[model samples]
Target: MGKNLLFIALIILSGCKGISQEEKKEDKDTKEIAYAVSKTDAEWRAELTDMEYYVLRKAATENAFTSDLLDNKEKGTYVCAACATPLFRSENKFKSGTGWPSFDKEIEGNVAYDVDYKIGYPRTEEHCATCGGHLGHVFNDGPRETTGKRHCINGVALDFIPDSK
Candidate 1:
């Protein structure tokens, strides 16, 4: 009887441990950190379209091959749509066949990364450093000639600025 009670207590404690860990993670994710550009949730929603708000603020993904920028080949810099911070340069862009704007590298210091487990596995999620807007993910499969990193960015998260002749 004592052993049975101890076993049940142990099981309950382990379940509580998992819940506490999940709560800690939620708290960490919700803690606000100061960025170069910060806005209230209402302001962000008012400024961005529904899709943009979903992808940038809520970390939702757009459908592959649905971005207007997927086929863009013009020379320019890609800036964060939320904060207009320069992210990837045209020279770093490449055809990754992933239906998203792929860059071998980002303009230094403009992007930040965090681990995302939304899909049941860990992925490196990139975002604009200035406004903390979700941009996309980074993968290791990329051109060997450069950084060997594929920065797969969301079109709705970026705005292209054509280079002057």
Candidate 2:
């Protein structure tokens, strides 16, 4: 019966090790990141609407073709809804027909990026550099004459400021 008891001990030990590793990974993922426009969860909730909170803080995507900015042709700057940081210019905007607003490029130094595997594959996730709010994704399918990069942004994440004439 000694062999049986040893096997049981090994199984328990292996299980515990697995749990410890999992916990470490979880902790790493949820670790706090301080941003230039840092705020508590309660503060963010108080300031943002439900949809804004979901899209900016929780990194949720809005439905395609639902953004009022999709057909916007006015000259202006698109800023981050959460922080008002200028993200995209009207000059860089294009009708990508991808439902969401597309930009050929972002206001350089205002956007940040990271890799996320939430969909089981790698995608470049963009964020507002000032507040760390989720903006959207950048893809390679864009005008080759320009940046050749498609900044497929969620409309909910942006606020348009029409240029004063």
Candidate 3:
């Protein structure tokens, strides 16, 4: 079932034609920015794992507790799985006990948010500003004295490289 849905999404997105970076813009009132990716589903699937494709392409949620990134204590940047765009800094990662990898903030404006109606509730969907890979959702219920924004991310959407030296 999930595979079928992913194929449909791929077909729809593939037919969108080519979009250039210079044409990318956000609606003044909506604040929604269009993400342009030039990769096809076959190319993306060949490059990413099933779990990564599930989240990045199909928007399917993975078992938070089962993800390895949640327990990862490495010191490095978490980059986008699709395009290798630097999305989250290692300093912002925190164990929010939400099962998934959580972050207080992104590296400056690397993350973008929009309304996601996939699930019944009106949630804030976050994506990578570089390749527009779906990171996760942002919640208002976060730790105090910080940005107060809990970036609930899918572990498969990221690749952590431990810092050396």
Which candidate leads in TM-score?
1
- Cα displacement (angstroms), candidate 3, residue 151, comes to 0.3
Model 3 vs. true fold: TM: 0.75
Ranking by TM-score: 1, 2, 3
What digit string (tens of lDDT, one per residue) describes model 3 on residues 1-165? 999999999999887876332344343234534556557679888988988888887777888698888988878988888887788888888889999999998877777777765554467888778766778999987778889989999998988877772
Tell me which of candidates 1 and 3 scores higher on lDDT: 1
TM-score of each: 0.82, 0.81, 0.75
lDDT of 1 by residue, 114-165 (tens): 8877775668999999999999999999999888999999999999999973
**Candidate 3: stretches off by over 4 Å:** 1-37
In model 2, the Cα lDDT at residue 136 comes to: 86
The clash count for each model shown is 0, 0, 0
By TM-score, how accurate is candidate 1? Answer: 0.82
Looking at candidate 2, the ten consecutive residues that score lowest on lDDT are 19-28
lDDT of 3: 0.80
- Weakest 10 consecutive residues, lDDT, candidate 1? 19-28
Question: Candidate 2 — which pairs collide?
Answer: none
Identify the candidate with maximal lDDT: 1
